[model samples]
Target: MNQENRAGQWSRARQVASPNQDARPHGEVSLLLLHAISLPPGQFSGDAIEALFTNRLDPNEHPFFAEIDHLRVSAHLLIRRDGECIQFVDSDQRAWHAGRSYWWDSALNAWRSKLNDFSVGIELEGDDCTPFTKAQYTSLVDAVGWLMARYPALTPQRITSHAKVAPLRKTDPGPAFDWAYFRQRLSQAAFKQ
Candidate 1:
C-alpha cells in the first residue's frame, strides 16, 4: 500500500490500491469533484481514511466508523493536511465516490447522471467545520494540474464539489472551503505550468 512508482498512476502520490473501483465506462474523464472528509468527524491525518477507502476499516474502532464501515467508496486521490498525496484508484478508472449524483451537462444540454463514469474524485483531508490547510490546497493544485495534463477535457471550469452534485445527501468541501482562494491558486498554477 506504499508503492512509490507505478503505471497509470500519479508519480508523486503513494499508491494504496483501493478495491472500490473499476474501468471507466467510455474512457473519458471530464469532471473533477472535490470532497472533504475526516475520520471520527473533525479529526485529521490518520490511516482511518485510507482504511475506509480500502475496505479495511474496523467498525469497532470508532462510532463513526461503525456507521460508514459498510460503504464501498473510493476516490481517485486524497490530499492530506500535511500535503501528502495518496492515490487510491487510478484516475483512468471509475472510483465509487459519486453515488446517485447528477450535474448539468452543457454539451448534452441536459442534466446528466452517473458521474463516476466520467469524473475524477479528490478527497481533501478535512471536514465541513475546519478550514483546510494551505498545504492541502497546494497539493490539490498540483494534483489538478497533473490530472489536467492527462485529461484534456478536465478544465478548471469542469471542477466542482461533492455538495454541488449531491446536495440532498452530502455537503462536503463545505462552507469552510474557500472557493475563491482555491480558484486563484489553480489559476496561478495554470499559468506557471
Candidate 2:
C-alpha cells in the first residue's frame, strides 16, 4: 500500500470527510494517538463507525448508538480489520477524538493539554477485550511510520494509546494491544523506508 501522506491525506486511503473536525490550534501535529473502537462495542464491518464520524448514525439502529450518536467525534484515520484504510479528517486538522486529554512532551519539557490541538488520532476496528488483527497491526505500523516521517516532532516515544492520555474517561486500544510487538514492527517498517 502507498504510505505517502500528501496535504494531510494518505495516498492509499479512502477519503470520507467528517464534520467533526476543524483547524488545529497553532497548526501543530506533534503527537500520534492510537484508539480502539467498534460499533455497538464489539461488532465490526458496519456503517456505524463512518456514520458516527459523519454525524449520520441512526440511534434506532442499536441501543448503544442512542447513547453516543449525539456525540461529535472523528479520527484522522481508521484501519479496518481487513486492513482497509479510511481517512475521515485531514492530518492537518483537529479531529474530535481525544477529549480532555494531556501528554507530557519530553522534548519541549512541558505538559500539553487538549491533545487534539497537536495530535493525530488513529482508530483501529477493535474493542478493549479483543486483540486486533495482523492486517490491522501491519497497516497501523505503516501509517504510523508515514506520519512520523511527515511530522518531525513525532517519534516512537510520542506515539501513545488513548487510555494513557484520558485515563479517567477512556480505556481503549487497551490491554489487548501489544505495545512491544507494535514498536518492533514499526521499527522494521521505518527501517525499510
What is each predicted model's overall lDDT from 0 to 1? 0.92, 0.90
lDDT of 1 by residue, 1-193 (tens): 3332234599889989999999998999999999999998899877999999999999999999999989999999999999999999988889999999999988778998999999999999999989999999999999999889888999998999999999999999999999999999999998886
TM-scores for candidates 1 onward, in order: 0.95, 0.95
How many residue-pair clashes does candidate 1 contain?
0
Candidate 1 has which clashing residue pairs, if any? none
Scored by Cα lDDT, where does model 2 land? 0.90
Supply candidate 1's per-residue lDDT for 91: 85
- Model 1 alpha-carbon drift over 4 Å, by segment: 1-6
| Total residue pair clashes for candidate 2 | 0
Give candidate 2 regions above 4 Å deviation: 1-6
